[model samples]
Target: MRATSRFLLIGLASLALAAPVSGQRSDDQILPKSAELQKQGRALYSAGKLTEAEDLFETALAVDPRNRGAFVDLARVAEKQHLFGKAIRMTNKALQLEPNDADAIAIQGEAMVELGAVARAQQNLQKLQTICRQGCPQVAQLSAAITRGPTVASAKTPETPKTN
Candidate 1:
C-alpha cells in the first residue's frame, strides 16, 4: 500500500484491530461523494463483510461506473474471497477503464499473479512503477513482489473498520 492508503489502512486497522485487518491511497486527492459508498464497502470489508462489501462496491460502481478505485477495491475483496476468476474479471474492468492508472495497473498485476499469469502480472506491475506517484512506496513493494514472483502466502488481514 502507498503511504496514504497505508495511513488509511492504519486507520482501518485501528478500527479492525480493536475488533480484530489492511492499501495505497492518494494524498490531496478529493474523491467524490461516491466515496461514501466506497468507505462503507471498506468498512464492511474490514468487518469481514465480504458479501456485503461486494454488494456495496457493486452499488458504488453502479452509481459511478467510471470510478476505477471501486473496481480495484472490489477486485481485491474478491481476491481475498479466493474468487480468483471474479477478481480477474473485476480487475479487468478497472484496467479497461483506467488503462494507465498506476494503482489499478499494479493491482491487476497482483491479481494476474494470483491467477497464475506471471507474464501478465509482471507487465502490469512494471506499468505501475513506470507511472508511480511521488512519495508513494507501495508501488515499489508491488514492483518488488512482481519481480520476486508469487508469495503463495496470503497477507490478508480482517475486512470492520475502526470508528473514525
Candidate 2:
C-alpha cells in the first residue's frame, strides 16, 4: 500500500504540469508551477501547517489572482486557526467568484456553526446538502456536529422538576 501510494503521488506530480484547460481566458489560466504550489499548500494544510499553508496559498494567489481554489484553501486554513472572521471573509469572496461552490458554502456553514450562528449554519448546510450530488461525506460530519453541539451544550434538567 505504501509503494502504491508513493507511485500514485509521483504520477499526480507529473500530471500537475499538464496544460491548462481550454476555454480558460488567458488571464485566468493557471500555470503549472502555481498548480503545484496549490497542491503543496493543500498537503501542508492537511498536515496541519496552517500558517505555512496560508503562505503558500497566498503565493499561489499572487501568481493567479482568480484562483477560487486558493480562496477556499485560505478560508480553510483560517478556519483551522480559529480565525472565523477571516474565514468568513475568504469564504464570501470565494462564493462571489463561484456562487455555486459547494466546498465554499460548506466551509462557511461550518464556520457559522462554530461562531454560534445556528440558524444561518443550518441554512447554508441545507443548501450544500441539496446540491451535493455525489454524496458529500464531509457534510455528513458537519451535519452530525451541528446536531450534536446544541444537545451537548444545553442543560437537560429543568428547574422545577424535583419529584416528591
- For TM-score, the strongest prediction is 2
lDDT of 2 by residue, 59-106 (tens): 988887778888899999988777877888888988887887888887
Runs of candidate 1 exceeding 4 Å displacement:
1-33, 133-135, 151-164
Task: Find the candidate with the highest lDDT and give its number.
Answer: 2
C-alpha RMSD values across all candidates: 20.5, 16.6
TM-score of model 1 vs. true structure: 0.64
lDDT values for all models: 0.73, 0.80
lDDT for position 55 in model 2: 95
Model 2 lDDT-worst window of ten: 149-158
**Native-vs-model 2 lDDT?**
0.80
Put down candidate 1 lDDT per residue, 104-134, tens digits, no spaces: 6666667677666888877766666667646
Residue ranges of candidate 2 with Cα displaced over 4 Å: 1-29, 150-164
